[model samples]
Target: MRIVDRAGASTAGCILHGAVLLASLDGGRVYLLNGPAGSAIAVYRLARELSAFDFPRGLGR
Candidate 1:
């Protein structure tokens, strides 16, 4: 499925910040839902654009 989050923060700055934030959650911790789907998709979209992203296993498991 083409995961498309068309709501929430969708700006470059927001995306970058989101990536940094998510990356920091690299140990399987309870990530409090801080924002909406767009905020979350920002990182995922950035990852795909860069072609060098992977959600570490055991994350949010």
Candidate 2:
């Protein structure tokens, strides 16, 4: 898949744990945790586009 729009904050870091993908941006102030399908192909397709935001510290697990 390709990125259709080139807008938004730059990605700072990314980590994959099992099926979950954690993406950090804006100097780690913002993050996006995505859990796509278990399969590789399905994950790739679902990751085409995702939104990120600052997760509340109190809400973290």
Candidate 3:
């Protein structure tokens, strides 16, 4: 599945692992609580995508 921001931005890059034990979105930041180490691949990918947004702006972080 492809992740998406409130603005409908494509956050699919954030999906680090297929397992995705846990995941949450903190404003502009997408928090993946627990997942396999291999998920790091998606972390960086998300970082690149999220960089465009002002993370933690909403969700009352």
Candidate 4:
């Protein structure tokens, strides 16, 4: 999936195994939360950087 900020910036990546939460806050910012059961929860700032590789080989499948 792709997440975009209000400034017209975007990032693309896949959620291999997780529950994603997206929220748009004040300013031109966006928040992306990734929760994967027992693993660590990840919080990302949208439009900061794009995914280098969306999915490689058999990954994210």
Candidate 5:
């Protein structure tokens, strides 16, 4: 699913670009954290192809 739409891209879901393997979490929850130009999308991004690139990135370092 798209977290934001600024590229006027009518796409839904991600592009799986530059993904990462996050440490296992509680598993009972679905965490949604995105920043670093959609770096957070790495995990599921590389898999599901999630993306926030078109949207404005937020959250400070």
Candidate 6:
């Protein structure tokens, strides 16, 4: 999939959850979305990206 950025540049998009969610690379961040939040979750660095994906798993189930 291809997505347009704030600068109007077309970039590759990685679809998540069967197209209901999208992850894209922009500048220096990996943007995550739920498709209904009206905004995105962005990870700007390797550590931040790891932490972002890790935080959700920290809650004990």
lDDT ranking, best first: 3, 1, 4, 6, 5, 2
Off by over 4 Å in 3: 1-37, 58-61
Instruction: Write down the worst ten-residue block by lDDT for model 2.
Output: 16-25
lDDT of 6 by residue, 1-61 (tens): 3344456665444432112212232333334534444223322332233432343453223
lDDT against the true structure, each candidate = 0.38, 0.30, 0.41, 0.34, 0.31, 0.34
Backbone N/Cα/C clashes per model: 0, 0, 2, 0, 7, 0
Query: Candidate 1: lDDT of 3?
Result: 24
Quickly count the clashes in candidate 4.
Answer: 0
Across 1-61, the per-residue lDDT of candidate 5 in tens digits comes to 3332233332233323222111111121112444446444444534343233422332111
State the displacement of the C-alpha of residue 24, model 4, in Å, after optimal TM-score superposition.
6.7
Cα-based TM-score, every candidate: 0.29, 0.24, 0.28, 0.27, 0.20, 0.23
Model 4, span 1-61: residue lDDT tens: 4455566776644443111222332233233344344222233332122242322432333
| lDDT digits (tens) for residues 3-43 of candidate 1 | 22233322233445445434443331122155565655556
Estimate, for each residue in 1-61, the C-alpha lDDT of model 3 and write its tens digit. 3444466564344353211311344333344445666465565454454423334542123
CA RMSD for every model?
12.3, 9.7, 10.8, 8.5, 12.7, 8.3
Q: Stretches of candidate 1 above 4 Å error?
A: 1-14, 17-32, 51-61
Clashing pairs in 4: none
Best by TM-score: 1
- Preferred candidate (lDDT higher): 5 or 6: 6
- Model 3 accuracy (lDDT, Cα): 0.41
**Candidate 6 error regions (>4 Å):** 17-61
- Our model 3 lands, by Cα RMSD against the true structure, at 10.8
- Clashing pairs for model 1 are none
Cα shift from native, residue 11, model 1 (Å): 21
Question: What is the lDDT for 59 in model 1?
Answer: 27
